[model samples]
Target chain A: METMQPALKNGRNVWDSVNMPKEEFEARIERVRTAMAGRGLDLLLVYTTGLTDCGDTAYLTNFVIRLTRGTLVAIPRKGEVVTFFEGSSRGLPSLKQTLTVGDLVAAGDLPKESAAYLKETKVNVGTVGLAGLKRMPFQQYRTLTSALEGCTFKDADDMLADFRICKSVRESDQVRRAARIVGKLTMFLKETTFEGASQRAIEAALYRQARFEGAEDFRMLLAKPGREGCSVGPADYVPMADGEKVIFYLGVEFERYWAEAIRTFTFKAGSFVEETSPGIISGFQQLCAAMKPGVAISAFCKKASAVMAGKGHQALAPFGLGGGIGLGLSEKPLLTEETPGELKEGMTFALRMTAESGDNYAMVGNTVLVGKDGGIILNVEPARPAE
Target chain B: MSDPNLKLEKTLELINKKGLDGLIIYSGGTCSILGPSYLTYFCEARPLGPRNCAVVTKDGRVSLLVEPVWDAPRMAAKAWITDVRGTSRFTDDLLEIVKGYGVNGTMGLVGGREMSEEVYAAISGKVKLEPTDAIVETLAREKSARELEIIYRASRIADLGFEAFVGCARPGMREYDLTAEMEYVMRAEGADDIFILISSGSHNYEMHEPTDRRLKKGDIIIGEITPVCEGQFVQLCRTMTLGEPAPVVYEKYRMLLHAFAESLAQIRPGVEASAMSKAMNQVISDAGYAKYCYPPYMRARGHGFGIGSIAPGGVIDDNTKAAFERLQAVVVHPNQYIPETGYLACGETVLVGINGIQRLAATETKLYVKEV
Candidate 1:
């Protein structure tokens, strides 16, 4: 759940044509243009920071900033799509490697440069749609709003979100690849002797292996559930004591798609054994059985809550039940009690379950595919119930 | 949370001096090695969630509001402030705290660039905002004894990371895999975070995120290895050769060594920060590549680092206004580009002390050539 720590982006970063080709982005832009026409928006300005919120921009243009800066993809009603990022012009050689958009401009200030583009292209008088405007830095937002005097602004976050909720064939493949990389990460953990090793030793080795397996980005949060304090990221690098139960929440983003999974393990003897609870498994399986293409997300959330309650598992408010995953860690059609949306086929969502395991809390979940036939659990075989 | 009282005491003094009702040290969950979290400077708690802020009013009342709710317990243990709460309802809770204090006239805002439209609007409805990044900058311009220790430790981690780069990098290894090995060594050395950029090829343009591009025998692997320890980010820019033998590569890297040394010679407690860059640029210019010293080829010759103030700021080019001050932690690099070698990295972090400059890392800045 602690997914917001700033990423170093120290892993594999590329725009693989085989995985997500330029044709995909071209189709995405065409669809966005059609959507803009429906909404009477002459230009759609998609915005996202370089952090976990870079889905909208990455969805439209395969470009993602490695640094903590702002990026805007301006898709006009027609003409070549332009990408603006907050950086120096020198970054083009590196940025152009991943950016599918043709017209890339590096600016000291994205808002100021975007405003200049708006005037240069005579877009100030046109109705513009802003996606992910709320997430933009206030300084940039202020600059953008103040610079464009005659522009009409409309919120297109939902429109862009609607487009991203359902993954295409290529997008689903990316997620599957991401999930497979996650499998390698967990496999490395099981194979290595990290049970009694220091936390940093295990984390460093695990991350190294994950990158070798082609992880673009990685995040992990270990829950020493019965420990003294929250102990975020194991600051002291405490050695894992024998027979200690811990939940390892790993989110691996391969290419641009994210595949998040939570696994529970108990260190016994000299090896780590899976301790995923039976209740958590049965509860998620029931939800999978209930899922269909047209099922409402609210109903899914309701079922999840009821099913977990029956299994003696409590929904911890801090770590959410789970949400849709694809381009973003959590995208539209999020699983929440009040989320108003319907699940569609090809939409991927990760479901998480938390249950008290004796003296400690254990968690387990997997990336599930909202299939045309039924819900498909993407990865993570449920381990045997702990004695 | 070492010397939290010192920071709080300084902040309170500034509040009194500026006649402000209170001060808010905020973190938008955007922590960079260059510009770290200001909230961490004030309270020593690196915020894991977005919109983590601490309110320090004039009456000595302090409250820490963190998002994600789960991070609150960890923050509580890390922060000296006892009033730490994991915030669920963001804007409402923040406004409530501001309103409850009856001190909503003019509040100093740190980490203001991180604020979003909603947060700025919600806070602006109540108080006037004063850009107060300087408050923390002033507090951090001079390092404490503990800060120097952390800076050195972080620098040592950077050294180890680069050593890993030297050991793990070889022919057929992907760029990402090389970085991962480096990150592993740094993390084992207690680095809380790491930022690494790598470029490998015959003619490298710039260092970006690690890619699947494989390193070849003659590839020049350039890496900007930064390992952050307790938010004290130390960067080491290095250029390595998979196998020796390009005369131009050796010549260009040696020129960079001269530029870096000249830059180091220009550091003092009273000189302009731009002077170091100018001195470095002059050496490059004397080498007959003056045109490449500016943008599109070169970035900041150096930058400052700390959890709080990254003073002497981003680019220490011809226009940087900040001056070199005593005990200021800064990274001096002569990372440059030439048509011959594409680009080469050479630099190390240092402490500008009262006596002279203190090099933090034990690794010497030079071209490290790994025999194939």
Candidate 2:
């Protein structure tokens, strides 16, 4: 329960290596039960609609919906957990393969189905904790409340978020696996960039390599030095010109765990040169050295700011430093001055630092795991310095 | 590039028509190809995380609030809205923006269904919040020239996807491997997003996500190839066989092909959307599968694909009364499950034209056989 089985121990299948074992899920459920008891909640209902919100449900069941649909998980304080899927009955076969939750039901309408389940189980009259309430449709919330009749509902989104924000040994291992994929992909990107290669071809190379390495989900953000900023959508058809500056921020999810990597490069004499400053790289390494358990995340932000400033540089606010990474790509304990939390041992985070020097901007990002000793850089795709 | 200002103009017109102080349209969750993320329709930048909101003031001012903080740059890079800001706290930033527009009058809220209850309460506590999904839908039903261009490009990618699905189908290949190959092809072709579902075996009940199951000779494969380019989506539900040798499969497939052709023929400007379903159902009924024409057999004849503006409105059933308009894009999938051959898929996307439906897919609807 402390550490997860390694994804690639000795030349196992990529799929076999990357997937979470059943013990990991069992340990997670035990953790949730303990947290649920502390909160005096009888049942925890996790509702998720669409792709991004599935983190809450996936934490318990490992069931991620591929399409844009609503899904709910009802975890009782004592017994079996039931999942209400957003699809039809025909999806049961696929659902069974993807999840371990035994009591799976097909619900065309999630709210109505959940209400019926609550009433049937006679738990509708008790105190129920709800996560992902904000993501649910308003009408469904009204329906759920009306059906509960006498039940008192409380926001338990943070309860789940708080539990998931910190990674376990296994979760950290998954992050490492995901980070490894991101590292390899970024390296491929660096090697593939040419004077005339289109962004489409570059992204295609990324997709091919990441998926081959068993990445469940992959997202990319790219920007030219002169562009307004980076976007997480399609790559344009424009071919790269010689000496054009490009910045790439890539993230990948393996076995439902997340990691990220960012690098800024300029296409030079038929190659890519790391368009970054020694100050920024030093600032990043300094920030990593500063990351320790019990250090307030805000304090880390201040330290990052100071590190950059001492190096005659300034990092961007809000998004520059980092945030906790685990089940979700950007989890709580965000590394920002305004955030009110402390970094804990066993938390994995992505430190993305963007600095502006004159008319150019450079960014360096990598996933780091907070250990008892210090921070461990999980996905290390080192940049080749500018010539 | 399409003028992001065109959407700003439309939002202003909507605000004026609804007599609202401002409009708040939001997209929840970054992964939804078809969720209530109408913000993409207005801003052109679909967020990649949970919760992005756009505030359109009646005075020609538009601002976007993006979540996950990292995507802020992406939103600014892609969206036409000049006042895009990134935030870690979604509800607070949303409240701040809504109040900036004088939050005392009726505020039209698009994508209300996807809004969390806490967000709704906070906003409505300040003003009269009204759901503007229908209004956005009405406006989105007619595509702009730029929207059509993106949708058409997405359709061409869908065609390439099917070509991959066909070219890569062979015995001994795992379903997921086939999916990986096809997705690589589409992604290389500039498909920004894709949702592929595959089911193999001659007795395929329905299309599902690819599994570890390996294809064998004589096993038929069904796939729904959906690709999105710049928020515009195009889908094709096609079927292929590892080897040709089934009279009943083709017989059942021909019925679906006939239904598909007749259904597409029913498309024209001003036609009731339900007519497409009825025409499709009639062909299935003539083939003596009327009992199976309803749910569990198939739920939709086709659905409109866009950000959130035009859905098949509802599933294309006999009871639907929504009418088609010019420039609306829809996928006419007549994928059916019958006792004769289990299930078969045949469909293509089309653009509703002034006189007839414009087919986006060049691949004709038929039972494509891969020579083993």
Candidate 3:
């Protein structure tokens, strides 16, 4: 999650009607409208900024901001939805081709543009539910609130997160497709030769491989096998030595859906053999099996912690026990000691479990879909390396 | 560009001058070529979390606070500050750290604009956070000797990126594939971050995110290749034709090349930054496309790239009031929508000084032709 932000998000750009149809968006909007009706809200503004924070708006409109810019979706109770994004007015022509919504405006200033649009549409005066509006830079937030003085705004981030925590059939399919890409790339990594190659060279090769595989955005962080820090970083320029083990924290977004996969491999003679602790592997399998619909998230996390503590393995901290993974890499209902939530079916997340072998620390993880029966790991064999 | 000791001295000076208890250069993780994280400049390390700040107290002690609670070791390893603490509760820890310092006076916030409403409101409740972005901008506008060296290295990576872009441009390859190839080559050369926008067609409106559109015969591939090294970014813009370029294509691109040169010639310290844009526009207008100098046709002629400030800002048009300064890292491009050959890209990054300009990249600013 701490990977460097790529300047140009040159990924697979598409608005697949079959995979993520307009009807899907219509359904999402309707769901939000239903929530709005209960809250007595007249309009909902779901705003986001930058590549990482683009999820809230992207959920409503299948448009992601490639660079650092503001994007928002405005859903009024009684009218067609309109979305605004940060870009030059000239780009509106080409940008229009990418969005599911017909009424889209490309503007330099989002708050100003939203205000002007609302003033023109006469929807400025009302109680509006604001979601992810806190992600904006303070200046822009002030400008937005000042411009829409007639509207009373309530924070709807929790409501929005509750709705977005669960994956729909199409959303799950999109995640499946993204996870498949991760699986294929893991096979690619396992089979490839890293002999005499710099860590960055491997990173470059992986970037190329993922892009060619139709991956839109790719990020990988390199960590030494024994490294204790959870915030694994970008690759250094040094070549990966043979017999040296490395752990990769990799994530890719396919058509707006994200899937992250973590695996550790021991390098020898240009090839990789996965290194997995039998105890940790068995523990993770049991933990995933325990991830049922009615399982309390904190309890599950506490149990995982207890198991790890018993095995003399410590939590990896921030990147340790994983959380929800969907439009954003980390969503709500995170698996933590004190986070109040339950593992509901349809909630998707990156499930990671760490193991210790002597002084070395190793981790294995994959994108998981919480199911009625249990946690369904959305990965191929050897991705988890337990096979 | 100042050394850590010098930065501390300056920070102390600013705190004393402003009558403040401390200074906090914050990072809201809104880092890009458009804007570099202010905290990255102060800390000399990129904090991989959403909320990180460098806290400089009046006691001359500087401590870093990084989010995610696990990035502390990484920050401690690289940053000049010895006290690097990572916290999951960023807002709470930041407030606690400020209270621990125990100064009830005001605090200067360098990147106050970057903070979200949640963070701003949270900090405002306990302490008065005032925006001090411009003060740091004025302090760091000029590059240090080491930063300049890194900029040159980054520019070389940009050149390599264009070389890769040229090597990968071919018929039937997707635009994103070309982007991947270019990015890989740059990454292989140690470019920290890459920002590339590309579009392929016979005639183009503007450069955008690389789509699935494959290159075809006679397609004009335009791109903005930016390779960042340690927060210093250098951009290269080039337009290549898949096949033999038309006569009009050659003619129009030549004008852009001339405009680029004209713009470069005007880039010395103390001159109004608008002079460069005015010069570039004059060449295109003189070539009988004066009507295409404004928007709906063209955006900014250029923008400055720096550690903490992308000054002269995004659009360096004739209306821009800022003057070009010494050691300023700026990317000057005449990327425009020309009716004759669609949009042709031509630009270079340069270091501004008394010597006018030192070109960062070795890539020639002209139309590239990929042989059929």
Candidate 4:
């Protein structure tokens, strides 16, 4: 594989490097400050663990901790932002390198350091907003809470989630690059016949091809049409049979941005087994088509169920309809029954549809962007066999 | 089915022979237990959340104790071991299971190092808590043919990652950026879990986390790349020198290679693990670089690699006393620092056979020179 060159700013792509420039970042912080003032939030503590929930932290500060430890980004209603990361004296250089000179605190003494810094800086702490603290350990939460004594802790995950739902120009470019790679690999897999090959061999071939396509990270789950359950990875060595339907959920990461696409294939060219059945496909399409800027998420979910039922397939319950995707594989603004509000433009979601036919099951999903006209498919490819 | 049963029976017999009433396999979510990944060897699935354990008795009955009521059914189905029970609190549930077994006379805790203070106190009150790394280590050391196949595949993936790193790591790029690219490549290669520790500098002071420090001309980028496949661990540590390396750096690299050679030379069926560490230490010590052998300087010379047998015999160093056994996989990284050339990584994972040790990975041990 050859090295991937940094992307250049151009109108050829949906996004460019300019989306994440220092000026845009400063503007985003300003927007956060305005939102905080509106919500009466004096301070906002955004926590991220590993690569999973680091988008918020990375948005504010370009640093992403590689370890499985928590990193926090503290943004007061008015002041300089500060970051806390776990490490020893060895972390000093890294802190200096990744963070701005004025925006760093040793993670070992984070609570004390944050308190001292906040007090010295004289930032008001009345109503503190927190995002991504659901998985945060209690000790860390307690420390932050205790440090800001009179502040009322409120879940501002929605505030952060709202900001994350919309993809900036740079993020869209990265996702588009990742999507192109995934699309190329999916097409390659379709051409590569699987007869006499084990699942492991086929998976390995796909992985190798993805790397060749310049995907930074690739993950795939292969399920035979009539298989019992979703057995991801290359562990199962089931040999490919002529009539078996193969489904692949493929994801690729480019420059730390992730995009995913799901496709199904059959061995025979004309034999279109309901590899991810069309009934499920129609349901997903209806949901995707209905996703507009002003439509409530709950209403969209209801429409999804009605579409599934109308197609004579068991309506997939709320859990599988997918949600936002960015730095992490899955993000908020989830399409669940309890989801708070409306769909917005620039937001991305994976519209998933799964159905069971007797013993056989099939699923088809695609990442989509909410456009003014309708949801646009990020990974565009023919669903049927090539003539 | 019968093979696993027979193996369990033989293990139980060995337990009887060793005069231990029961073996307590303790695993918790921490750096010591290395998180839930190690539990996959016995349970066939990674444990979720805090402390959970599977205790097998001399009489052949097994019980799995876990926290949180919701995880019980999932653990039971995934582990393929019925008699799965759980507790809201780990300490009380652990005590109940031990008392129920009636073999609480002398218990051997597999991962005693990571047991919580509350759980340890509860168990020690009723049963004698003996710290024996043998229970899990012995089970993990001998990989079944099926397990070996997974490790072999994982090693191949690691090689692919190294190739990816070689292509992507360049001057004017930040360490974290390279790390992100490498991880993204590995994920694309279908790697489920990756533990990559890397460093880059003109002189790599120590091998630690990735930083945003931009690589300069003639910098050395060292990486200890490990990928987890089917819950098995396979690793390769290599150093890449950007542009032409200085004479001193090359000499230090040669010394590290020599130290690794001395360690590899000591591997055999009957050789003690400590002997191999001693041999390697002597090579560095004789070269007047002995002070970097232990703690305040270096953590470990080498360590055993597998699903759950990370520290059974302890990390290979001059103080190690574990004996080499057939099919025991170990990685020897004489990854040390020299005042002249920062940190040099020279290591390979090898499997001990009857006659000698065989390298698991096919990557070359020599320093890779990446042209800027």
Candidate 5:
């Protein structure tokens, strides 16, 4: 058995050092500033709490913290960006290490401290936009509202969400990297012959491998062959059997970007016991081929459903089809009946199609980025069919 | 037949001994299960939905109050208790049910710290809510045969994870990739919930979250993997050296292994949980690594693992006073910090038997080495 190499040291990893070029970051900021001006907003207070908030914060400052508490990115209309993080004086060193010199601020005063800093920096808060205020706790909201009493706080969460919906080349690269890792692991699991292996053992192995491959955070949803439950965590004692379907929702974080894919595996060669119909393979292919830039998401969903219906497989609920992928495992450009927009170039999304043939359900999903010409599949492996 | 009621009787005896009027148990979603696990130990079935509360009185009249009106019927059918009521709004419904039961007198609230401020205010205003760790601790400290069966099964699953790591964990792989592979296998096998914390480095500062760092030729990857079975938690902490470990790393491993052994040796019925922690600290301190045993360096040596109670005893330092009881299951990791090696993971789950402790998981004590 060959020993593995160490991947982390002194609280910093390779992902921490991966930087989006300063020029590109400035360009994104300039785009956001233009949007702000069009919306008649003087400033944007882009707030994020816990691990989920890293996207907005990283958009302004290329910093990401792994703590459970929240961080706020205060983007003024005309000045440098500042961030307020949770913790005491002891956290300053780590704060400095993770954030840039101009972006770090003590969290003790929080909204007050942050608001005062912005005022001192000449932020005209008369027409400020606030994103992620719902995530802000009551106490923090009170402090910020008290500090910027004269400022009008309008919701700009939609603006931030819209801005992030389009993926940059750098962001696409990270997503592709994450997708490649998932592809390799999925292939490995298919080859492992999971009969008699308990759920806990399988989960432990996947977690170890994910860490070894540079995944910062991992979330998985696993369903056994016979048990078609919708739980997110790992189950214990349940063993793999000969003719069951396993739905695996795998997500990995690379450089603060999240990429997710869902795949269903079976252990035997046969259609589902009840339906005896062909699986969702053709449907998935049809959806993938139909998905193109400038196409309406609802139209895409309708086409996918039509393909499944033509194949005599039960079409999945429109909501179950996947959506955009980026900072969060699930993002915008959602595939729903009332989806309001069209797929744009540079937008990345998970093309998930689920079909039920008799008693068994088959799902195939992959992370793909919208290219000028067509859809660029991030993880380029064909779906593995059960033997 | 070994009486199934023995555990419940023992729990009630402990409740009387502690002089508590009643225990208020609440489960907040599946992730937070302080309420349901404690109630389920006496009764069966978990409360449905995100929020559910159960009050087990001294007279054995158990009342289960849950949010989401649809889940009440499911809760009633699953639990043996008769008084199960479902409420649409949690705070208002919770107050009315408690008031109806007249449990507003001196009552002990288990798992109330994580409750929202609105729930806390409602409960405190009506009843004198005293936070007690005893409610879940007494029932959860000792594992039942059924609980043990689930935990043992969970350990077997963890062992599969070990094998998977050995098979797939290689240099150049990203951390999340390995995690995804493991998760895929676990889910394929039928895992419900898994909590995994992994670090890869020769000098691991702490067993923090996973990162997207490609494994290097000589990185040592450590994982603290735990799978929550039913309501019980079974954990396995193991460290793997990717390539030939540095001599200094091996030395630190030996020291940690010895420290782990010393901690295990100290486990027995009636021993103060804190004493075992202190004894383990002494093993490291005597070796001139005292600073590593405390904060900014190392968090806790180990903690209790079970269905409803962690009985963490707060980082088992010298002044800690939590005691170990018979049948209690605990995980003691000699997770030490040294300037040479950041944090080396080594631990196991042990059941405090009548005589001594029995190891649950089937992992070897020595450092697991995988040559690159």
Candidate 6:
């Protein structure tokens, strides 16, 4: 008899850098079930749709729906979890290759299918937990409620949000990998970008390097100096003039975990060069310094405001500090004045802050892991680029 | 030169015909494929968030409501509707707009599925709600010259993507590497959005988002490269052989080519869309693969490609009943899984013309054999 090699439990295996081992997922399920049991929940239904809402479902199943559609995963207190997605049943062969969830069902109408599955499982009457319900289409929510008439549904987005806010060792490893790819891609952007190069081309180049490094999803938003309100996806193929400020807000998901970075570049003469803002850098540093374990996010916000004020800028208006970055581009525990959570140990955040002086606008961000000792900056580049 | 005014006039005409007070075209980002976001059609705007609703009154007054509340500046810049308002409170803001338009009488709803039950309940009692999906579909069935130009440009971008697919399909690279390269070429060429799926193996099942599986010698590569410009989508289903494939592979590919050719021939203005599927399926069935033409073996012969108005619906199986209209853009793929050659891809996007089908892509539909 041949002896089998033991499953490795270290930093990113070549194959499983983004995707953790089954044991990690099993442990997560145990944590979730414990929370659900305490809350007296019979089943937990995690509904996610479109690109932005894909994190909650990916956190549990490692199954992210790439298409612009709705997908749901139902986890009962006892039985196996099942996934329902908007695709043909024939596509199950492809789904199996991507996701580990076995009982996959093709759903034309998500709520109807979820209701039918709930009825079949004899979970007709119990307190149901609904995570990511905010993003669910109102039509589906009504249908789901009407179908499970005897059951009670409660908003449990915080349940998963709280669970996913803190990163495990393996999850942190995945975010670091994603951050490394973002760093390399941003560096490439700084080198190859030139005048007459369209936003589409610059974004395409970023995608090329990131995908080559095995990124699952790449999202970018472009804006000019005065036009700070960036839209989603690539803009028209318009060239930037020399001495103009061009901002690229980029986020990439490796495996299912996510990390994001923001950088501003100027078309100086003939080439693109990294631009810096002192006010933004000062505020960003203050936020990073305050990201200690057991500290409230509100305290960090106050510190960030003081740094901005001391730097001759106004108080931080909670406009730019980023949120949690894992499984989703922006998760719960957002670093804002109104955010309710504290910085816990094992938490990871994408610390981004922006400041304005005169007509110029500057933004900088980096992914950091909150450890027992202090915050560990996962990104290779600093929060703000050096002059 | 896209004409948002002309599209809006056509929508108003449909509302007048339907005997409604006005129309509410709802968009839930990319999720509403069934009743797709017609905002891009009427206002030349694509939504960034989950929900964006446009209310057009009978008096030519149009008000738009978008989510995230922050994208108002961007949305207002793109849309001609001056009464555009961004909202974080979707239901409340939209209700105010609907009431402000004095839409108390019978009203037409273009995207019924996009509206939640709560919104429906809040407004249905105040007005007679009529689903105007067919009206919107009819108006969008015929594309304008500008729309056709955009579709043509999108097709050109897809050709570049296919070229990159061929260039990047090396032996040792992962499937995602090829996908990335292809996407890079298309994006650089100015494709606003992209939907790429790839499968590489000797016996492939279906094209999906590229996995980390590395390509090897004699691997068969299948790619469904879709590039979107403005709102028009152009797709190309292509299969390439990594090395000199087996004789059986060539024979099966030829069968797919025949099916593709036959299907493209049936795509005239007057022909029903199902006829194209029937013609394509017939070619495969006649090639001693009768059992492989149905589900689990194959899916759609083609689907309509657009953001606002994907007419003839998204799927064009043998049971589809809609007829092809002139200027309508659709992809006619006869991708099949056969016992002899496994899954092979062969398809191209075409414009339904008065005379016959006009091929949109410059790339010929045939098996590409890459030498080892």
For model 4 chain A, the run of ten residues with the poorest summed lDDT: A1-10
Runs of candidate 2 exceeding 4 Å displacement: A1-19, A223-237, A274-318, A336-345, A353-362, A380-387, B1-22, B29-37, B43-49, B54-103, B171-173, B214-217, B269-271, B285-291, B353-356
Candidate lDDT scores, in order, read 0.82, 0.75, 0.83, 0.67, 0.66, 0.75
By lDDT, the better pick of 5 and 6 is 6
The TM-score of candidate 6's chain A against the true chain A comes to: 0.87
Off by over 4 Å in 6: A1-19, A225-234, A277-283, A314-319, A382-387, B31-35, B116-129
- The residue-by-residue lDDT of candidate 5 on B157-217, one tens digit each, is 6766666666778998777566556554544444444556677876776554445567887
Model 5 CAPRI quality: incorrect
Give the Cα-based TM-score of candidate 1 against the true structure. 0.96
Model 4 per-residue lDDT tens digits across residues A1-387:
001111110001111234455666677788888998899888888876643446777666665554546677789876788777754444455345545323766655555666667777777468888876654544455566688787788888767667777887666766776777777777777656656766655655665566555554556655443333343332245567777666677777655667787666666642324365456666677777898889889988777767766765443322267788776667777777688888888787777766655655666777788888667778765366668
Runs with alpha carbons beyond 4 Å of true place in candidate 3: A224-231, A277-282, A298-315, A337-341, A357-361, A381-387
Q: List the residue pairs that clash in candidate 2.
A: A134-B116, B304-B312
Q: Give one digit per residue, the lDDT tens place, for model 1 in B44-97.
A: 767878788998898788999998777888789888999998888877888788
lDDT of 4 by residue, B344-372 (tens): 88887788878888888777888899888
DockQ of each: 0.67, 0.28, 0.60, 0.12, 0.12, 0.40
Residue range A1-387, candidate 2, lDDT tens digits: 001111011110122323577777777888888988888888888887655446888888887766667788888887778888776676676557668554778888878887898678776656789888666778887887787778778779888787787777777888998898888887786676455667777766676677657676676766554344333333567776787777777878776788898788888876777776777777777888888888888888898888877765565433367687877767777778898878788989888777775666787888999988668889966477999
Please identify model 5 stretches exceeding 4 Å from their true place. A1-159, A179-315, A339-343, A352-379, A382-387, B1-142, B151-204, B208-274, B280-283, B319-321, B340-372
Ranking by lDDT: 3, 1, 6, 2, 4, 5
Cα TM-score per model: 0.96, 0.86, 0.95, 0.68, 0.65, 0.92
lDDT of 6 by residue, B1-372 (tens): 367677778878888887889888877666332234576676777767666788888878899888667667767887888887888788778778878777888778777765655566766766677888776677677677777778889999999999999987899988877888888898788877677777889898777777768899999999888887776778899999999999999888988898988888888877889999999999999998878888777777788876568877788989999888887778888899888777888888888889888888898788899997
Superposed by TM-score, candidate 1 places the C-alpha of residue A121 at a distance from the truth, in angstroms, of 2.9
Which one is best on DockQ?
A: 1
lDDT for each residue of candidate 2 in B79-197, tens digit (9 for 90 to 100): 88889888878778877887776666787888887677877776677667878777677667666788878887888899998999999888997776787778888877888767787
Ranked by DockQ, the better of candidates 1 and 4 is 1
Model 5 per-residue lDDT tens digits across residues A1-387: 000101111112333445556666678778888998998898888776545435777666666655434577777777777777754443344346545424677665577777778778878467888887645644566668678888887888788788889888887887888888777667666655445666556655565555556666655655433234332333345565666666777777666676776677665542222211345655565676777888888887788778877866544432267788887766787877589888888898877766665566766677888888767778754476788
